[model samples]
Each structure stands twice: as structure tokens, then as C-alpha cells.
Target: MKVPLEIRPGSDAGLGYVKYGNGPVHVLVMHDWLGDHASYDAVVPWLDGHALTYVFVDLRGYGQSIALTGEFTVEEIAADCLTLADQLGWGRFHVIGHSMTGMITQHIAADAPSRVTSAIAVCPVSAAGNRLSPEALTFFASTVDDDNALRRLFKFVSGGLSDEWADSKVQHSRATVAPACRRPYLDMLVTANFVDDVQGLATPFLVMVGDNDPGLDAKAMQRTFLAWHPNAELHVIPDCGHYPMQACPRYFATVVERFLKRHTT
Candidate 1:
């Protein structure tokens, strides 16, 4: 069954989130750069709700937290997530982060290793960051307001997926994310480096990437996530690109749940 989107508004000190399921396992799922929590809507129906509960969170200036603003740094995001978890009365929980937020997951785990049970990073930017060149950074920053540019960028990451899909994603992003937050968050994605904080982290991590993802591919995972964490494992989803939750929801849920279940005990 499709889970209803129930938005929980944030307080002055917390981020807003959508709660799903009533299961034993608690999971905090964070969205990527483009869209909000709604980005995971495609995989909601396939989720094993009977065994797992998910809290889909909106970062500052996104979705339910659209009115909120912040420093937009990884440390700030990690702190916000921890604050949200405490508000939800979750003592220890699993975390799942997609794209840019995936890097935040590392920070969360590092900051509170005892509280985060395990982490799943999907097509994530590494802690070392993308380190984009000045010109490339300018090109990406320009896409914040340009629909066509955003669509083209999504298309490339999705391995030349259909225009219809890219368009839908762009529209969703425009609707949910505030334009002012994009550049600041993009700056963090391309330049922030905190590999030193997370290196040798013992918290288990499932580093998942789409086989067709040209940027954060399996090889990239090997050199970054897998190399930095002692208890990390890599899984490449077949016939997929950057956004597997959108492109292959069923399989994505299955893989995610399987890993989550393994560490639940």
C-alpha cells in the first residue's frame, strides 16, 4: 500500500518530517539535492512497512521546512537530523541518505556513532566532496533558476533517461525546494571536505549506486565510501542510473530493506 504523506512541522529547533509505517525498525530517510522527501515516493509502496518505520525529512528550505533557513553546511545538516531524531523520541535509528544528503549521513554517523545504528548512502557524494573546478561550479550554480539547465543535468546523471522523467523531476524540485537555498547547498556539495572525521568509522554502511551512474559510480564508491569506512559494503544496482528510487523502485526497496534488516538485530 502507498504510504500517506503526513508532514510533521518543525519547531524552532528541529526540521520537519513525514512519518511512514509503524514497525519496529526506525529509519531516518533524507532526500537529495534536487527534490525533497517526495523524491522517495516511488519506493514507498514497496517498502516493508510491517518491519520498518521511515521518517522522511525535509532539510532546511525544502518541503515542509521550506520556510526555515540555515548555514546549509554538512555539520549543520547533521545537527538538524540529530535534533529531529531526538524530537521523534528515537534513541537509536538507521539512516538513509540520497545524493548530497548521503554525505551528511557520514557526518551524522561520525558525530553520533552510538545513536546511528547503520547508514545507507545512495548515489552519494563522498565526504571528500566533488571538488568541482571554478568554471564547473559556475555552470552548476547557474542551473539553480534555469529549468532547462537543471533538466539537462538530471538527464546526464540519470544516464540519458527519458525527457519525460527528467521533466517530472525538475518540476518536482522547483515545486518543493526554495531557489535561495540551492546555491548554498550546491557550494557545500562541491567543496566541503570532512573525510578526516569519518575515516575508519565502524558504523556499518551500505554504499549503493546505480550501475549506469557515470559520476558517483561503483569505482567512485571504491575509492571513497568503501575505502574510508571499515564496515562499508558496495552494491551496484543494475539497469539504473543516479536515481534508482525513481527509476527502479521495487528493486531499490528490496535491496535497501535487505541491508537494513540484516543490521536490525
Candidate 2:
């Protein structure tokens, strides 16, 4: 049975989080660019609360942290997560990041190697950055202000399915995300290259890719995350798109929990 997660207010400098379970292993979860903590609602129940404590956080410009002001850069977001952990009195914790936060997860692990025991990224953006055609770049850039465009982009990314789901995602993101932070974050995910920073990092990483996530295909992942990090493993979840936590919650949670169990100290 799944226990309810507790909503905890964050500090002045950190983003708010939903705390789940009371296990020895601490895990910080970062949502994707288009979704907030609510994105993990389905997956939460399937997680092993007895073995892992999950902290699902909203990025500085999204969810409960929308009011907080910041540059919304990957480094800044990583710092915010670290600050939240410190405020919670956690010495060391595992990190899980979805979509854009996945790339941010890499930064967090590299920035504080000793503090993060292991990291997991789900349908993550590559740490090396994305390569988009000029037209594609323009299209994505324009979605910053247009919710309909954003919804269309979501559908395009999710393999042309789940229109209603994508619509809800766009609405949630538009309402919760700070308008100023959207484009900057998209720029970071597409242009910020951290190859040198994460090249030889020893922190273990589990990269979970939804088989249907057109953006992060097997070859793309191999060329980036798998190639850049020394200690990393990849798992492909079948019949899932860019948002596996929403499309296949039970499987997603199980895969993540199993990886954590293997890596837990």
C-alpha cells in the first residue's frame, strides 16, 4: 500500500517539496520542464517508501517555488536543491531528475560529488546539450509564451500521441511556471555544454529512457550521457514515451527503486 506524501514548505532560498516515506535512503526528485511535482503523483504510490525517502521538488520557477526569483540556470537550480537538502539536515542523498531536471541532476552530482551517492535521470535531456535544427529551435523558442504551441510541442515530443495529457501538461506548466524562466531554461537545455565538468565524474548514474521518447533515442543517449559519464548505465522502458512516470508509473517506479536498492550505501 502507498502512503500519502506530506507537503513541506521550503526555505526562503529553496524550492518547496513533497516528502514521501521515512526510509534510511534519502532521494531528491526533480520534475521535468513541462511538469511539476504533480507529475510524479502516479509513480509515488509504486515506490518503496519503506526503503527510500523521496523528496519531489519544484524548480525555482515552477510549482510552489514560482514566486522565488532566480536566473533559472542549471547551476542555480542545482544550488537550490542542495540548499533544500541542507535545510532538511540531510548529509547525503540520492538524486532523481526527469526531463530537463535530468540534465540538472548531472550538474548537481558533478558540483557535489561526495554528497550525492547516486543519480538517476528519467527521459532526461543530455548533459552535453541538444542539437536542434534551426527551424526546430525557432519553434521551441516560440512556445515560451504560447500555451497552445507548447502543447503542440509536447505532443510532437511524445510521439504524436496523448493530446489531452499534453494539454493538461501545458496548462499546468503555463500556470505554475514563471514566464521569465521558460526560455532561459530551454536555452540551457539546448545550448549549455558541460562535457568537461562531467567527463570523469565518479558518481554512479542510471539513465532511464522511455522507448518512445523521440528526442532521447538510444543512439543519442549513447553519443551523450553514456559516452560522457564513466560510471553510467542505461535502461529502456518499452511502450513508453517522454513521460514514463505518467504513462507507465508502476514500471517506472519499480525500475528506479531497483536501481536505488543496488546503489544504496
lDDT score of residue 157 within candidate 2: 69
What C-alpha lDDT values do all the predictions have? 0.91, 0.84
lDDT of 1: 0.91
In model 2, the worst 10-residue window by lDDT is 2-11
Which candidate's TM-score is highest?
1
Clashes of 2: 0
Task: Estimate, for each residue in 120-211, the C-alpha lDDT of model 1 and write its tens digit.
Answer: 99999989998887887877887899999999889988965799999898998999999889999998999889999999999999999998
For candidate 2, the C-alpha RMSD (Å) to the true structure equals 1.6
For model 1, the run of ten residues with the poorest summed lDDT: 1-10
**Model 2 lDDT tens row, 1-265:** 6565788654575689899998889999998876678889889778888877899998877777777777878788888899889988889999999888888888999889999999998888867777679998998888998777898888876754577888888888888888888888888888878878888788899998877887887777788788888899999988778888888889888898888999988
